[model samples]
Structures are given as C-alpha cells and as structure tokens.
Target: MSNTTRSKPNKPDARAKLLDAAFSLIRAKGYCATSVDDLCREAGVTKGAFFHHFKSKEELGVAAANHWSEMTGIFFATAPYHDHQDPLERVLGYLDFRRAILQGEVREFTCLVGTMVQETYDTAPAIRAACEASISGHAAKIEADIAEALARAGMKPDWSAKSLALHSQAVLQGAFILAKANGGAEIAGESIDHLKRYICLLFNRS
Candidate 1:
C-alpha cells in the first residue's frame, strides 16, 4: 500500500492573529467577557503563543486598541474624503464617508475602542487610556480640517476646534450604541445625518 502523507498545518502569525481575534471577540462580547482562552481558540493558537506575545489580557487589550488605531488611521488617510479642496467639504465628506460605511453588521461598522472604553473605562485604566488615545487621535485629524475651515470662513466660533472634534466622536459612539440597541442602521444613519446638518449649520453651509 502506498503511504499517504498529511499536509502540515500552516503556522499563523501569533501576534497579529491574537490581535485580530481579540478585536473581533471584544467587539461582540465586550472586553471583560472575552478571555485569553477565547482569543487563543479564535486565533487557532496555543496558550504559549498567546502569552509569548502578550503578558496579560490587559496588555493584549492595549495592543488591540493600538492596532485598531493604526489600521483605521491608514484607512481614513487614504479615503476619498481627503480629496476635497475646501476644508468644510472635506469635513462633510468625512461624515458622509462614515455614514456610507455603516452598511455591514453592527460589530463590523462599530468602533472597537469606543465599545471597549464604555465597558472598561472605570475598571481598566491602561485599556481605557489606550481607547482614549485611539479616539482622541482620530478626532485630532478632523480637528485640523475644522480649524482650517473656520479660518477660511473668517468666523470665530464659541466652541474650540478641540471640543467640536471630540463632540463628533461622542456623536459617533452614541450612534453606535443606538444602532446596536435598535438592531439596525436606520437610527444611526439618522443621527449621523443630524450631525451633518448641525455641522452644516455651524459652518453656514447650504
């Protein structure tokens, strides 16, 4: 009888795989409920592999938030919204882009850092800090455009650019919660539209 040889399983990129698994599981089950075992099982890796990369679950949470930030930073930086010549148009386009991307499952479109912070802000300081950095870092990108648009319009606003920037994130995180509760994107889309309308009114954009 001819001997049949089985193919060896491919080795996964343990760190990246663990991060991906954590991002997905945390988004679905919340940070506290998703254990290291769950992440390892989802990642198809061993406990040794998980611990080799991350010393503790908290360490993994921090890394996951940073990974999400880096990934989304690249995604938005290369997005078409940046092509607009007018800063206000760019800002509006960014909102429109965000609304447009809300087509998939709630977990697919929702913010990882936003979800994580809401659950762990009080209990997990390191993870909360990571989440804050990711959210604030993203807000800073839009804040620059807002500042430019304000300067171009020669308008002095009552609110600082930083507040408005953070406000946008607040709206988005709230919208995600509504979408999750309502079990659809309709309410979330409406909320984003309202945000768009408010921004338009603020900038006096017709």
Candidate 2:
C-alpha cells in the first residue's frame, strides 16, 4: 500500500456541517421554508449523512438552536464589553457591542434562533421551545450584568433586569425583521441606536 494521507471521518464533523448549514439557510429562508434537502445541499453532505446524524429535521432544528446558543455564548463571554470595571458601564458597553456588530448582511447579523422561532412558534413546538431556551439563555447572560448594574446603582425601580434583557432581545429580533423587509442594514442599526438610547435613558445617562 502506498503511504498516503487520508482524513478520518468523524460524526461530529458531519453533524457540525449540517448545523452550520441550518444556521445559514434558516436565517435566509426561515424555518418552514428551509427544507432538509436544502440543508443537505448547502452542507455538501448526503441525505444518508443527514439522517445518520439527525433523526428528523425537527431534531436538527433543536440541535441547531442549542449549538447556536453555545457558539454565541462563547462569542459574548469574551467580548470587550466585559472589560469595563463598572457594572453599569459594562451594560452600556454591551449595548455598544451590539451596535458595533450590525456591520454585515441581514442574515449574517441576525440571530438564527430568532429567525427560526418566528415562523415555527405555533407550528413547531419543539423548535420553538429550543429557540426560547436559546434566546432566554442569552438574555440571562445580559441579565446578570444588568442585575449587577441595578445593585451597584442602588436603583429600586419597578422594572426588572430580566425583563430589560429580554426586551433587548425583542428589539434585536424585530430589528432583524425590519432589516429583512427593508432589504438593508440601516434600519437595523437605527433600531439598535434607539435601543441604546432607551437603555441610557433608563439608567439616567446622558
């Protein structure tokens, strides 16, 4: 036998390819419209490979949401916003970070889980629940900083950190929809701008 290099195929590699394809295709086409065939085509994997990894398309959706959460969790954890010593500054810095990241195509900048949940909320309960977990999980991260900011500021207001954090996600998901409908990123940026302002006003910052 000739000495030659060959790659050892791994199940995770194929599963990851399918999940990555789902992230892109679902963002572009939404959940109901992005069929399994499209995922296979985009992922450059066979139907057998697809089915070998995922029991069904819905199962893939659930995995995609979880994977998206994992990927983004790391992305935000090490972000520059966390560098600020002051908790409130960190919160504002998080807003700035969000605004700075709106510098790509609509699908590229938008949330994959958000894109999926909108269309699947009623028709696909599993996907919807997975999406809710992903969104709420990310919001929980923000809520931690917000809660710290609230405690440090000694602000005893009616509103809660959890609510504000989830509201931030709502604005972002809605901004993505506006970006899709208007066929540009400007609207999304403007929406983030407004969100930033709202947060600043909430904390009584100029």
Candidate 3:
C-alpha cells in the first residue's frame, strides 16, 4: 500500500492570518527584507493563497497598512483612556496608556506602518501612501481631544490640533527607532515620559 500524505486544511480567515503574519514579520525584519515566501510560511498558507488575496507583495504591503490601522483603531477606541470626563485628562491618559503598554519586545510594541514607511517610502508610493493614511488616521482620532484640551485650557497655540497630533506620532516613531538602536525599552519609555511632560507644560498642568 502506498503511504498517504495529508495536507493541512485552509484557515477560514486566511486573509486575516496573512495580515497578522505580515504585520509581525515586517515589523521584525522590515519590508525590504521580508518576502512573499516568508509571509506564506509565517501565515501557514501557500503562495497561491497569498496571491489569491493579494496580487503582489506590494499589494500586501498596502493591505497590511490598512489592516494595521483597522486593528489598532479598534484597540484604542475601546481602551480605558477614553473613560476620563475631561478632554485634557483623556489626552494625557492616552499617553499614559501608551507608556504602560511598552513592556514587550521591540517588534511587538513598535508600529508596523511606521517600520514599513521608513523602508519603502522612497521606493514604493502605494505602500507609502497607505502607511501615511494609517498614521494620519490614527492621529486624527486624537485630534479632537487635543483641540478640546487646548480650548478648555484657554491657550492660543501656534500649532494646529492636526499638527500636534502628528507630532505625537513623530515622537513615538522616533522613540521606537531609538529603542531599536539601544536594545531596550527604557529609552522608549523615557521618550514617552518626556512627551508627557511636554504635554503637561503645553497645557500648564505641570
């Protein structure tokens, strides 16, 4: 009798698995280093499945950015930081929450879109645009709180809420890079602490 080999069954959510795998692998190895085969193996799916969902690696990069935005948007929306009645408190709480969540491996905590944009921004316009949208979309979610905080404090700042919101992301992405260089989360936490202090000073809460 001939030996029989059994193939693993396909996951009902293969697309989501691919996105999750891409997010993790890309964060660890970066866009240029990760390949279609890496994603397929990581996702436990075949190249055929991957191509069926995403036309190419570049297409997957764009989808991954959008996936990152959706997953993280839901995460922050349901986070406890929003429970504060005061908008300024909510804003500060959001930063505090960010700090609190920094206990993990660098790849685990770092932003996927941030990593991808740094690598592919010059080479891939579609991926870059998707990353920009993901980052800016997340920023816009907090812009309302920043605007309300500024108004409640009776402060006339030179910067718009959109700019300040973007600034916070800039600080975070920079912190992630520094942490990656330094090989620890302490520097990243300190960066966030400084950001919190800047926010306090801005709002005259310090």
Q: Which prediction has the highest TM-score against the true structure?
A: 1
| lDDT of candidate 2 over 74-170, digit per residue (tens) | 7788889898998878877887887777765777778888888888899889999999999999899889999998898889789999999999999
Note the Cα lDDT for every prediction shown. 0.87, 0.84, 0.85
C-alpha TM-score for every candidate: 0.93, 0.92, 0.93
Alpha-carbon deviation at 112 in model 3, angstroms? 0.3
TM-score rank, highest first?
1, 3, 2
Q: How does model 2 fare in lDDT?
A: 0.84
How many residue pairs clash in each candidate at the backbone level?
Answer: 0, 0, 0
Error of 3 at 91 (Å): 1.0
Tens digit of per-residue lDDT, candidate 1, span 59-91: 999998998888888788888999999999999
Q: What is the lDDT of residue 22 in candidate 2?
A: 84
User: Can you give the lDDT of residue 204 in candidate 2?
Assistant: 89
Error of 2 at 93 (Å): 1.1
Q: Model 3 segments beyond 4 Å from truth?
A: 1-12
- Which of candidates 2 and 3 reaches a greater lDDT? 3
